[model samples]
Target: MLALRARRLFDGQEMRHDQVVIVKDGRIADVTADVATDVPAAVDLGDATLLPGLIDCHVHLAFDAGHDVVAMLEPPGLPDRMRQAARQHLAAGVTTVRDLGDRDYLALGLGLGLDGPEVLSAGPPITTPGGHCWFLGGEAAGEQGVRKAVRERAARGVHVIKMMVTGGEMTPGTHSHLLQYGLAELKAAADEAHAHGLPITGHVHCAQGIAHVLDAGFDSIEHCSFFTEDSYAVDHTVVAQLAAADVVVSLTVGVAPSPVPLPPRIQQRMAGMREALRAIQAAGVDFVIGTDAGIGPPKPHGVLPYGAEMLVENGYAPLDVLRAITSAAARVCRVGERKGRIAPGFDADLLAVAGDPLSDITALRRPLAVYRMGSRATGRVGQINQTAPTIG
Candidate 1:
């Protein structure tokens, strides 16, 4: 058994103080203010705030975060590169990630053991012929074809289904504002995935695509950017619809500070993107952050901390951002029972930072220590400003 006492704790929901978390057999045994004196080992983290390890709802481990990830995806060394990416997230205190797209189902076979985050994978996203991300090899047409595609992914044991309901910016011939799959095909994919006991999410951009996917009963929507042919637009009606629907929107956010500016197309739409985010927040839509990590130079595998900061900077409540990255993200990813909370019977996946994130959201960037399944994956207690001494 091991005990860790911290100055404060965010139990995946709210903040508390003077808490001690006890771990045994790779799970949290208890989280209480009463620290048992009989515990064989104890570690005191001074001037630190403990939080449940973060979860990134969307990432593409197959694409290395570079200027041209599609061109750089060489098959021979892809798996090794993916492993390194997963470790990057782990080291940054992200203990869970849902790989929404990958080449040849590689994310499911990473076999990273205790050193990496728990990976939930969608092997290859289902898309229409010549549609967005067709290069990843999931292509289908019509309702029947989409149903079959979902079945195949389910057979491969994918944790969720990712279907392209619209084109994407990454593909040259595609248009992010255009719908790729019709309502029939989208509904067929969602139904088939649900039949197999898997949740289905759609890659959508335009308001029409978002409405279609929501009508088809999709569990979630990704990149709800509401783009038009040339510039971007956020339809307030659709935003209201999203707020009233049962679906969750995985907002694409976060950009690490890098010398490379955002792509010209994205850079031009920055104001509209911010408007969409603000509208979503004002409408009180359910949301979680999906960094779209590994798709560009500004987005790296471990960039979730930046995402939390981005939301807070954009008029979002810091506490809400905290929940979005932790408990709310876990619920959307279907790991709510075990992965997100810092409570008893939960996996001992925890992050300790040097300061209170609620007060200074940037404190997330200063990770004092990370514990995955009770094993120290990165950081050290002594690294904090205050010296922490081990006790036994």
Candidate 2:
């Protein structure tokens, strides 16, 4: 048994000051305003904040954080690179990550104590033949093909099925805003995944793609970048439908400043992205914070917190941003009850920050310690050499 005392405790939403949290057998035993009796030991982390471990719902563990990740995927040494990437994410306070796309079950093996970050993997993203992300080798042309792909991934023990309903800019020779899969194919894929007791996540960026995702009953939509001209009108009817279906929207923010210049029209369209985010928040649609790490300018590993910080800068309260990364993200990733909170019976995965994160979000960047499964997985202590000759 261990007791961790912090200056502030973020128990999901509210931040309580001077809280003492008790841990036993890798689970939070109790959290109280007053220290509990019969505690075996206590570690007083003075002037630090305690928060649930952060979660990044969308990350490509197999891709290196580089400008040419798409090109790098073709190399023979991709597996080794992925393992290193996973470790980087763990060291940076990201205890959980949902791998949206990867080759084979590389991430699955990593999740099962093979490497780092309790990974929830989509073995391969479903895509039309030669469609977006087809380079990763998940190509399904018709309904039967889509069903077969989902089953194959399910048989391989994938936690979710990721499908590309629209094209993206990152992939060469593919239009960013084009819709790829039709309704029939998408419906078949979703049905097949549901039958196997797996949720489906779709990469949809355009208005049409969003509509199709809602109509086909996808569990979540990745990068719902609905670009518009005047008022940023994203089909609210579809947004309402998603809410009714309890579908989550994994919004990627703080992608880092892009060096490439966008055309005037597309720049205008990109401005609407935030409006769409606010609209989703107003509509009460479930939103999770997922930085598309390993893509564009956002470096992999430690970049997730930057995305969370962006949420706060864009009008979301600090607690709301925390929820987006914790409870909300876990719920979308289908691991809600197990992780994401510092409550009883939840995993001891947590981060200890040096300052109050509730007031200043940047404190999250420097985690004094990280605990995984009730163990001090990562941290250090400095000792001064008192015996050494003193310079007066």
Candidate 3:
């Protein structure tokens, strides 16, 4: 058992000041403001904030954070690159990451502690024949192909199923952001995945594709860029449907690499992504933060803190942005009860930052300590018999 006293605590939603949190058997035993109780050890951390370990909803554990990601995936080096990427994610203070696309179930094994990041992975993205991300070699054709693909992935113990409903900007030689999967085929994929007890996440960009994703009963939509020739507007009806169906939207807002050269019109559409997010938030759409970390330039997994900062810049409160990375993300990933909050029976995955992240988002970039499952996993405080830095 261990007791930790912090200047502030972000318990998934709100911030509590001068609180004491008890941990036992890798779960939060109790959190209170009263007197500190008896425990094996009590660590007093003054002037710092304790928060639930962050979760990155969309990451590619196989890609290095660099330009020319496609070239990096060529051949003969994918396996080693995947392992290095997972380790970087863990060292960067992300305790959990959802790998949207990978070569195989390598990310899944890493999540099971074979490597790192508590990975939840879709073995391979389900795409149309020669559709977006065909380079990863997950191209399904008819309904039979889609069914077979889902069964094979489920048998491989994938945590989720990813489908590319439209082409994306990052993928070369693809069609415009429109429906790639027909209604019948998409419905069949969803039905098959659900039958195997797996949720599906669709990669959608344009308005029509987004509508189809909603109609096909996908568990979530990635990107949902909502681009049009004239303006950007989420079909409120589709938003309403997604809300009604309890479907989530993994808004990949800041997933793109910064300042990439692009046409003016594409840049304009990219600029409007935040407005779309605001609209979705206003409509009470269930959403989570995902940095499409692997596809874009400077692609590395576990860059979610940057995305979280973008959420605040886009009009979310600081605490809400934190939840977007913590509870909200876990909820979208369907690991809510186990991985989100800092309460009893929850995993003891936690992070301590130097200052109150509610005041300044950049504080998240520097984690003083990272604890996974009731053990001190990483960070340097001090050796025995010496007090650590108060603000670390």
Candidate 4:
């Protein structure tokens, strides 16, 4: 049992002041207003705000965030690197992450310790021959082949099914604007995934591909950026349709402050991407932070917090950005009941920042303490403990 008292607390949806969160085992027992207490065991986080540890809806543990991502995922010691990546996320206060792409079902095999973030694994994304991310060995084609692929993931105990509806910049000979699978094949994959009672997300970069994912009844859409051959375009009609549909958009946002230039295709169209995102938000479309971490040099595994921060920088309200990363993200990843909120019966994964994050979002970058499963996993306390959390 543990009693954690903080000056302020963001309960994943709202803010509260002077609260004490009681934890038993690995779940939050209760939360109440702080008062004079004889309970001497409380860990008082002075002048700090506690919130639920964040969740990232999409990430790729297989690909190390580097210039040569394809070359990085070679067979030797891949699992160890993935474990380190998962811990890096946990150390940075990300308690949950959905691995959307990986090679050879390796993400599921990594035994990230209890101190590590909970990983929702998608073994390998289903893609067409030579399609987006075809190098991960998830290439499939035709209705029958896609269905078989879905079944294979289900049998392997994957948490969700990922399909590449359009080509992506990562794969050679594949354009971000082109659709890889036809409607029939997409529907077949979605249907098969649903039959196994799994939610499926589509990796789509073009406007038409987003519509196709919605029409095929997929649970969510990834990278719905409406990219074209040369520049990007945001179709208002499609954005409105997505708003009306029972689907969520896993917006891949954020980049590390690096001198490296982004891929040519993305760099050219980067100016218009923010406008497209705002248009989607203006249409009342639901959103969750994906970050597409580990795909390149700018998207390291623990960079999800920067995604929320970037949204705020790009005109999104700070509160909304916080919600998108916490509660909304958990909902998209299908872990809403257990993760995100710091309420009773929820997982006791919490992050404590030195200052109120609601006021200064960058405070998240300076975590004072991170608790996983009701125990303090790591913390930085004054000049005595300035060490960053090491990979567990």
Q: Stretches of candidate 3 above 4 Å error?
A: 34-38, 111-115, 229-237, 240-244, 255-266, 379-392
Query: After superposition, which runs of candidate 1 have C-alpha atoms over 4 Å from their true positions?
Result: 378-392
Q: Residue 179 of model 4: what lDDT?
A: 90
lDDT for every model? 0.89, 0.77, 0.75, 0.85
Stretch of 10 with least lDDT, candidate 3 = 383-392
Question: Relative to the unseen true structure, what is the Cα RMSD of model 2?
Answer: 7.0
- Counted clashes in each candidate structure: 0, 0, 3, 0
Model 3, 1-392: lDDT tens per residue? 98888899988878888988888887888888754556878888888898888888888866665555666676676777776666556655677888888875666665336234688889779998788887777889999999999999999999999998888666766655567888888899999999998999988877788777777888888887776655566677766666677678787755334444444556676557767777777777777887787654433455666677777777777877888889988988879988878887888888888897888987887777777776765433211111111211
Considering only N, C-alpha and C atoms within 3 Å, which residue pairs clash in candidate 2? none
Error of 3 at 386 (Å): 34
Better of 1 and 4 by lDDT: 1
User: Would you estimate the TM-scores of all the predictions?
Assistant: 0.96, 0.88, 0.88, 0.94
For residue 212, model 2's alpha carbon misses the true position, in angstroms, by: 1.1
Clashes of 2: 0
Clashing pairs in 3: 65-299, 66-299, 111-119
The local distance difference test score of model 2 is 0.77
Candidate 3, residue 44: the lDDT equals: 82
Per-residue lDDT value at 288 in model 4? 87
